[model samples]
Target: MRQDTEGLLVRLESDKDGILSIDRYGFIQGINPVMAAMLGYGASELEDKPVRLLLPDMDEDLQGDEWRAFFDSRIERHHDHLLEFVSAEGSLIRLDVQMFTGDGLQGGMTLLCRDMTLHLGAQESVFRQREQLSAIYTHATDAILLVDRRGYIENSNPVASELLGLSHRRDGPFFIDDVLRIKNHHDAWVYPFSQALIQERPVVVTDDIQLVLPGRSAIPVSVTASPVRDRSNRITGCVIVLRTTSESRRVSTRLSWHESHDPLTQLANRRQIENEIFRAIDHAHIDDTTHIFLYIDLHNFSVINETCGHGAGDELLRQLGRMLQEEMVNQDVVARIGNDEFAILLWDRQPEAVMDEAERILQRITAFSIPWRNRRLKVGASIGVELINADSTSEIDVLLSAGAACAAAKAAGRNKINYPSPERDSPSRASLSQWTVRISEALDENRFVVYCQPIVPVKAQRDTQHYEVLVRMVDPAGNIISPGKFIPVAETSGLIDDIDRWVFERLFTTLEALPSEVRTGYSFSVNLSGGTISDEKFRDYVVNRFAGSSLEPGLIQFEITETAAVSHFESALAFINALKAYGCAFSLDDFGSGQSSFNYLKQLPVDYLKIDGSFVRRMEVGEVEYSMVSTINHLAHIMGLATIAECVENQSQMALLEEIGVDYVQGFLISTPVPLNTLF
Candidate 1:
């Protein structure tokens, strides 16, 4: 029996694992060959070594006296402890050690050790993967939240905290119903979490979510929720994400402005005018109420912008906006729709009432003067009032017709308020439809005609001069329709380019037919619309029209309005430079009409500055008008540019313009816009 026990003890010691025996003093009494090898020592070296020698210095005290005290008090108690040890070669190893007291023949404590390095490495790898996934979850821009089946938030990321304005912490599970605050239709009961949850399917809810902040205003968030599932494919929880769309709301407000207000003035534009007219018509249909559309155009605003800087012009506009706002009824919709035009929508009003309001507005604007630099600039306004029957069918048509009437009033004189006449009533819907059809037919049949208006030199050193070719359309009555009536319609219909091509082709052919004397020393300017300057194809067609003609490239000046030239400056510059290379001279028409006139002039290569008609017609006894004309003439001369004054109505204005050094003049006084053959 003794021999068998000895053999069993020897077998356990040589078992190729780990074993140790300690004395009451916590010193190592015996160690197996495997245990010594694991600690990088021989059995003889480790046999009586203190166990403290195998551990790090910081842990020596922990396993030394304190462990001895613990063993003394609890001898029979078994305990498992993790320990770190430094081997003889200074490598760190982790081990799990079990200590228990034995009371057989040995009568001492036995220690069992397991090399746990591989098990610990596997656990560390799992920890690292969990950390990586958590990092991805925290940094994602999309707001993510985890909620249990009851809609209580379990875990949420930083994005959710930012979007919801809430401090999220891991606590007892929460329900989704409490967070969203959804209630029943009766406003008496709360909805259940199950009602809103669907596993793995996204649900969008665009309700006003109120978020309370720390002593700040409540923010609105748009929330979207989707359900999450477990490995068993059962509905476990949900994920909710939210975004703050305040800026989007602001953009929507501006879109409403784009529909009803002017882009420049931020006031109700022409579209709003039409809307007000229709509203009035609807009210009249039901309640027998009347309304008025007052078209108010600044009379000398063009002169102010052209003579003074456009900054001054803009100041004048803003001043007029304030004045109209002050003078009109509180219910009125005042707007600055055009460059120098305004409108007012008056409800429950008569023509006389509108006229009276118009007079007050005009007086206020005229009386108002803004100090610009060293000068006080004043301007006037013209108004036209049109009373509409509450039951009118075509409200937009009537509003535009009233606008035309206002323009006619301005043409007649400034500071005058004209009421719409019977001629200014809305055209028959059938007539407009017929006109639209006829215009389309005319374009398709190529029935458009080109007429040339001579841009003659006022101080004529020669008899023959250049002419500007204008377009006209012949109607079924054989009467020519002016461009003012149909050009805007064509432009709106995307057919202006075709019309421009036709005009260019016809002008080229007419120049080919003219005798050499008529064609020689005579240049013809053609007006290019804004639609044409940005159009590469239309520009190419213009170039091609002059390709095989008898016209000199320098003589055929392509006239573009200042507003159009400045709109797409880069494209205009490139197109103009290309045309210049082909010997075509360019002119900036309505030179002082736009805001960035001087800047545009410096960038554009043009031969003439066609002074806007506004400045010329206003060049009367006023010192302001005289000073403006003189300044323009001096500037043109300094820039080596010849000037043409438009709307030269009488010899008195003409004589003053000539004295002011205007090189050429064109209007009814010099000559009416005549036909091409009449010049011969």
Candidate 2:
């Protein structure tokens, strides 16, 4: 028995686990090297030492004889316990300990210990991750649902219950499709979760998705489903997230409406009318249909705006907009194009029928009145009807023709419909059609020529010669058509910008071809159209031209009409500033022509202000005209801008402009617009 006990002790010393033995007196009788190392001591140091040194809080009942008896009672039986000990590093450590009782002969207790520190740390980390997931799942905003492999609802967030109208008293787990029904825009049922589960990937439904509710109206929603996976990388179920999108859709719809309609009257605005006109022109071309375009100009309306305030005018316009809509058929279109101007598109109508409709609308507008603050407000409309057919060149042409007819009606007398007389208007229409072709041909064949009229200094001797550049087209018959006849046609046909670019390039090329000495002593001003000012491509072209040219930027000036600059104020300002940075100058040509000329003058960074020829022409005849020119010149000087008087046809006009402190004068008297070569 002693030999057997010695063999067992030797084997225990070689064991990987820690081992220790205590005597009846509770002293460490022996300890294996593993157990001594675990306690941060040598085997010899712990031998014969009290076990209470390792376990400081040993129970009083577990001391001396009691401890021996307690351990001996479970002899030949296995027992386990968790014990805590302090290492030499002053750190607390846990151990899984197995104990065995020795017989009376041995009279001691033996313990086997295994370190459990790493296992406990792993378990704690897992517990913390679970808690974080629980919090996120509970507090999510979008409706979230978890499903099983069979598409059964396994779990759901609070939002899911409320959003899907789920009942708290539901008996058991239900299928996802049984609880929620989703449809697409075409009224076809959509099953995003099923798709995700089958395809083992994410599925999204965003195109006009609607969630149908029991006994309630359907609501718009966006849904996404992602497949959930198990440890083996096999799809187990799906996670569905749904978000309501009705409010967002509503906002988008409202923005689209505002883009195409006027806010005050909820009627189509000018841009929408232009689109409709384009469509009408297309229809006319395809079907040889004749449409009527009515340009309605309200006369005597400004009287209400002046006497009763703009509020009354606004109310009147709103009423007029609604009345126009009421008088039109479903296929007909009406739009508000200007302050007191409205346009109506009569689709696919005979000429006689369109004429009759125009007459009726004219009478209705003339008789229309509204009561406002103890007074009845009345206004009249002049309606001009133009025919839209396969012969129509463009929307602008149709609009201009209608506008011209309206002006003629106003000139004839207001409150009537001016039907274009076939006999009188056909030649004008034919001329317009011919001019469209002619302009294109001219641009292609280089039939356009540049002319220059001198702009002479009024007060100072000229250091550099100044000229206002002009353009003329030589027709196939060798006839020079005045700008008054073709410029309007060019403008309406959308060829004005082309003409502008042609003039600029031609002038530049011609001047660059001139003798350097001759060109360096002169400055040229080129006119820019409204369309050109608004065109970004044209702006880039100008910049590139200037960058590539050898001409001096200071000698090249751009002239934009007052109305054109004011109409496209932002584009004009940007264009002007861009060129001005390159050392070029700008002139607000035909100044005092727009109603808000002075208001915009302060904002426009111009080097020159050209008084409108109408004002300059009559400055000699009337005080009002004379004051207009003088006031313009005075204001221009106040803003540090030079003033040029246009249409100085006589010496008297030049003398008057000089008296007004004008800096320059250009007209027939200065020099009839001569050929570019003649200027040398």
Candidate 3:
């Protein structure tokens, strides 16, 4: 009988199902090998032990009573119960148990226990995974939500709660439709979500969706939704992620403004105007619309700058900008393209309408008044309107043509609005281009001539006097162009340095050509531009050119304008002192024109002070002018320097200058600015 029972225990141990038996008192009467092994114990050891010892506390009390009660009934044949057990090593295990009551046996109960450990382990693993996933979802930066098929929130992360500004009370589950009120908040994005759910496909929504927060601050968000699916490929719900794009949109708008607008006046800059014109032309191409560009320039702005000051000019410009902004329509693009010029682009407007607008703008600008330092200053603008045809191709050409029209308007008169005319469309100044070509050719052919004007001593105070060297251009037509005309042109074209060098070389040649007697008691003063004085190489070249001449350096006085001297003071001081050490005297020309005072006068190392022509021109009749001349002469005398009064056009002016104590006088009254041969 023992051998047979042992064999039965082996068979039970090999079986997948578990078996056990207990008495009515909830004690283990007997247990199969499988049950014992599953509990990590021997069958003999488990026999007669209380079943409550092998079960977890959570199920021991209730399950034991239920098993006893069912066994007592006797009619309840087989009852199933889900039981939780604790192994001998203290690990929790789950079991599905079935109990049977024996017919003849007293206080006997049969329990068929299946392990169910692997299934419970797998369920626990899934629970833990869900917990980890929930943690990650709550901390995600992008707001995430799980919406059911009916557009109601089934589950959501903390990020979603914060993004939607929802309360976190644990009363009940929250619904997306109720909390977000997305239908009322962002109607534009609702369609995409509905479509995604119905079609069971992913969809993106990127409109100007607005979200009204608790404080009524509308936050714009861009939402994207995708359908969630289960293992069977059936749609469970949809997952939506919201991104707050309000800040990004603001940044994008600011970037666009900075790119197309000027920082100073907050108006369209040159690039913006160009883009507007191109866009206007493009629109006109697509439709039968007309476009016009108006180029407006302030007349006599330079005169205002000279007479009042740059501060007044700047205030006027700022006032004009404000006026333009106020008067023009929002659709028009007005821009400040030049120093004192503005451009306006009119789209889809008639030529007459644009002309009327231009006239109105001109009138407004003319009527605008500016408050200067202590007075009210008035100014006017000139407008040039040019129409663009559908066939126009070149933007630069249109702008240039408009500029030419503006120039014509200004030349005609002040406060004039001019349209492009065929007659004026042809070049206005033949002389300008002709002079440019002639000057270029003359520079290349060495046709520039030098003339000298004498700065003679007023009395017999000194034996030697200096002659001011001037340049003249002799064209192929044998006409001499004065320095007043060609010199300005040369300076504008950046050819003044070349012409200056040529003059120096000619002056040296003329000096060499002078007779010994004339050269003995004579000194020549050559005028130099501020640009040439700033050139170190030119300074060195001048020094080298006159190094070995028998004529002493004192006989060649270098005359520079007071403005030029002040601009390049440091270098000019060094150069002049070095040349003075070599016996070359220095003279300050146009002395009173700039802001030179007695302080700068003492600092400058010079032998003569040339009174400005303006002061000298009025010296004969004006007591104030005569007093200015006398004061300069007195100052020069104190500094041990001689004085030259310039622009003495008549005998009276000459006599007045002499009486003012001027050491030298230079004007056409004594003798006109004749050629060097006349002096000889």
Candidate 4:
């Protein structure tokens, strides 16, 4: 372990931030390679040095009541105190320091320091952008065309130049009417600039205001013309804003069907779909025909983008689009509305036919595979269906209903078809919007921490205490925040993998700081998020950690939830095999929670099966639950694997687990989670 520590220290010597320890008397007792480098001193040269060597404002001997007062007021679990230091090059360096008081009252503090140069730089950049917005807004993508009172073009921004097809024209005077072919609601040709200037008010055009191009077809744009005022409030010119509008954003406007298809999938975009819906609604009202709108979303497709690459994700989407086209009739319309999301409009209103098509599409997606770099990747999809008839509301209402149904399906678990009910609450969307900011802020501030929970053997085993590393967040006020409060938020936002990485890095740093007995004696079971399990970069990081660490690989164990493993079986197996090369053990955590747990367990080479805490906590109350625990325990042992019971909160529960041949147990009854410092 000492050998590994030395190697890791050497590897970490180039860290951008500094790390040091300060004694009770404000003496710098020890510093890591990073702090030494930051201060331009050898690691040994900084040992047992007075803190005044770094902080000149401090007295040579900062002891007595002064030191006592500092401890009483300054000691905290988490501190965001800032300090300025003269760097090795004699330049002022501002440092953001997070300090945690060490084990004892008189003990020193461990400081994790980060340089604030880059953060300050980003702030300055934002400030500069805000200050210069007026000068830069003209170059923005929004088209701005300036026309004089005579309806002749006076000036135009670059965006307008592209939109008006004027990029190829030389410098010359142009008339607004000659440039744009504007048709109004009365189906009469009108000049927006002339109208706005004559009326002294804005003249908006949402109808067909198509920009005529040289030797090409016209593209529709929403035109807004307002009189540009001078100092006396006199009309100096008419400013025309030309924005390209999709059929969905248009006000009762329709476009040619072939004009709005997504180029990649040759399927309709949102614009075309909107047009189709409008036509269908009119037809339904007149002919009494009915329809079913299906909103489909691909599950875990983001995993492909995160692991294999976005190119692979796009390819998978294309494949699914082709399959949908093959399964649908000519009357049915499909659109690639958003990323990994599609909408299909079924012409028939029969509930049975609509469901049959939906199921067929689901099956095709489930069985479909994409060729990603020489490997075949799997896919899953969820669907929501909304039936529409002659009595159905507007196109927008039906679209929203279809969306709600799709959301309900995903909430129930992906790869299933669901219909939205009037009473079912949809909180997943709200949770995502509320937690994204908080989770992002937590990550940026490095507010996450690792806590170790003791996992003791049900029977006599090693005296060394094994632990499962759990994650916790340290709020700004220095209070401990539970994982249950933020974990689901992180997972929903695809940020759980980031949190998992933070946990591992923190746990690894703590482990490297411990003595060989305390470090190597304990076996660690770190939780792996499903997102991380599917990420190639995560796999690489884990492999690199093992390559650099001095401890035996067997000492490090990984615990992946059963549901995650089964859902992404191929990816999980590949990840397990990669880490197994380094001798790291694996545990299938939360086992017996899934419908196909045993079936997938037969395929996994896991060393342990951790029974779900729900079963262990409730087994004593229900015979069925108790039988489940016994059956899982026996089956695991039969498969040459040990069992660990979670949430064992009493001696009776522990005794029951031992009687059932469970190998280990973890809960408040045995030990609660403690800081890594205390564990060591």
Cα lDDT of model 1 by residue, 1-680, tens digit: 01222333544644655777777556788888778888888888877767667765334556434655544433233244665667888777767765555444254455666788788889879977985787577555555677877666777665564444343222334455545453223433333235446325666645545444455555455556766778987788776765555766334433544566554454667767766677767777888776777777665565566567678887767666766777765356787766667777776775556667667767887787765653567877777776767546566555555565675686677687777655555454214334555667888877788777666666767554767778889886778889887776565333666777677777777777777766777777888777677788877776676665556656667888886677556557777888887788777788666665575577687778888888888879678767877787788888898888888899899889878878888887866666765655
* TM-score, one value per model: 0.44, 0.50, 0.41, 0.48
TM-score computed on alpha carbons, candidate 4: 0.48
Q: Write the per-residue lDDT of candidate 4 for residues 309-350, one digit (tens) a residue.
A: 778887788778888888776467889987678998877567
TM-score ranking of the models = 2, 4, 1, 3
Q: Candidate 3 regions off by >4 Å?
A: 1-433, 513-518, 677-680
Q: What's the TM for model 1?
A: 0.44
lDDT of 4: 0.74
lDDT tens readout by residue for model 2, 1-680:
11223434555746567877777678888777888787788789877866766753355556457655434343333243556666666555567665655464275667767777688779779967975786577555567899888999888865676566552334657789987799998889999988998788999889998999888778889999999898999988899988878766445434554566676565678877878888889989999999989999887665577568779988888778888899987468888876678999988898778768888888888878875654568888888888888977677667767877786787577687778777646767656656777889989998888988999999889888888989999898888878887887887556899999999999888877877777887888999998899899999998988888777768789999986786567678889999997788899999887655465678889899999999989988899999999998888889999999999999898888877788999999978998887877
**Candidate 2 weakest ten by summed lDDT:** 1-10
Q: Distance from true position, residue 200, model 4, in Å?
A: 53
* Candidates' C-alpha lDDT: 0.67, 0.79, 0.71, 0.74
TM-score of candidate 2 on Cα atoms, chains taken together: 0.50
Model 2: residue 678 alpha-carbon error in angstroms: 2.6
> Model 4 segments beyond 4 Å from truth?
1-319, 323-381, 384-431, 597-599
In model 2, the runs with Cα more than 4 Å from the true position are 1-291, 295-330, 333-344, 348-384, 388-400, 406-426
Candidate 1: count the clashes.
5
Question: How many residue pairs clash in each candidate at the backbone level?
Answer: 5, 0, 1, 0
Q: Which is the winner by lDDT between candidate 1 and candidate 2?
A: 2
